[model samples]
Target: MNHQGWGAPPDDKGATPFAYPEQPVGGFPGAAPGVPFGSEPGMPQPWNVTDSFAFAWNRIKADPGTIIGTMLLGYFISNLPSTIARFIPSDEPSDETSLIVTIVLALLGGLFSTFMMGGMTLFTLNVARGSFYRLNDIFQGGPFFLSILGANLLIGLGVMFGTMLLIVPGIIIALGLCLTTLIIVDRRCGAIEALQQSWRLMNGHKLNVFLWWLMAAVVSLVGILACCIGTIVTAPLLQIAFAFVYLKISGQTTADSVGA
Candidate 1:
């Protein structure tokens, strides 16, 4: 409850021992504590994904409300169209109406997803850089929405298209484009550029990222198991963890960490 603000609202126990240096925004929580002794200060310096979980968790604890609230809202909106479509029984056996409903639902879902992801990407990017944001940050993604949507669409197409060829190729395509959104958010690049960059960045690192994903997935299942509220914490933590991955692979550094 004593957010120093949100590491689940900052406590002596949870404030990241590591520092993410940023100027305290006028209305947000005061600046984070100074960098811990071992803090590095340069690019390509990878933060350990596993160890950074504590830090990421602390970040979530700092502002669980905004983060969780935004997530819940996104979840609702994204699923609402489908939920509605499901209830709308096809009038005739032709199924054209049902097909239209399905198409509309898919489009709505895509829009909601783009909006949510843009916000999440922005949120994670801010946190990784040691900045705090207001709840509105969730909607702030509108600016990047187009790029995020396009990136996702393209990545999906690549994966699906490849899957049409072979399951193995599809899997490969998926892993390769995993970092596409991050690239778009950070570099503010176009979808194709981001996908290309993600593929390149993931080069020689897909296996490690996959391992990290598996580990996070297990943790995620734990949250899902907890009647899903646990996801309020785990979901953001996963995002932050991947942010670290992107930062490391791209040779970007947080406020204090540097590459050794």
Candidate 2:
């Protein structure tokens, strides 16, 4: 359980302790020897879409309780506002008070949803790195709240503006910024800094990310077809897969790379 360089070596059970950095850095600090940093902005780096999913699947199998339990709790709590809104009386369309309540609840849901996303992003990063994680890790994103919120807000506005110009720009912006929240939490960077870093990190890999996302979406759809219950597995699989890809592409030490 002793923290080594970036994280402790895997114990007998193949689990490492979670060790987040206290001070923010430009990227994941303390790279292990022989691990190459990612390519320059214009250079293409090899990426395997399936490998990321395989890594995620392995981790989920190793710790389904923490993975699935955290996801479920975050999902439930984030949606509470909307869930409660459904039970409120709404028989009249012109009810100003009811309308105001609905708007407020929706806003609350969105705020909680953003925070949960940040918390889950951090938790999943730990999972991807093969570190220990617990259900409470889902609520550990408070420290990065301002940065996360700012990054998300900027991304939303940029994407919206890009979409107004053309749909492709919006998609491109989204792909480029997909890892902003992760970067903010992982590197302790500000919103604009995280956005720029993500954009640079994703260089030459956006297509691969998009393709991987498409595959994940298909997997989720299949799970839904089997019955929504299957999402418990598929959902965490997606989260871990995303974290794995981010670690791999950004040259951070992952569970798979720890021993090697």
What digit string (tens of lDDT, one per residue) describes model 2 on residues 13-126? 223133233323233333334332222223333558898889888888887887888888888988999999998898799999999999999999888887787678877877
The C-alpha lDDT values of all candidates are: 0.64, 0.74
Clashes of 1: 19
- Give the TM-score (vs. native) of candidate 1: 0.72
Once fitted onto the true fold, the runs of candidate 2 whose alpha carbons sit more than 4 angstroms away are 1-45
Residue by residue across 76-163, what tens digits does model 1's lDDT show?
7657777887787887868897888789888887777777776677667666656555555565555456667767767788889999
TM-score of each: 0.72, 0.82
* Model 1 CA deviation exceeding 4 Å by range: 1-43, 89-99, 164-166, 255-260
Q: Cα RMSD (Å) between model 1 and the true structure? A: 10.8
- Where does the lowest 10-residue lDDT sum fall in candidate 1? 1-10
Report the CA-based lDDT of candidate 1 relative to the real structure.
0.64
Q: Distance (Å) between predicted and true CA of 246, model 2?
A: 0.5
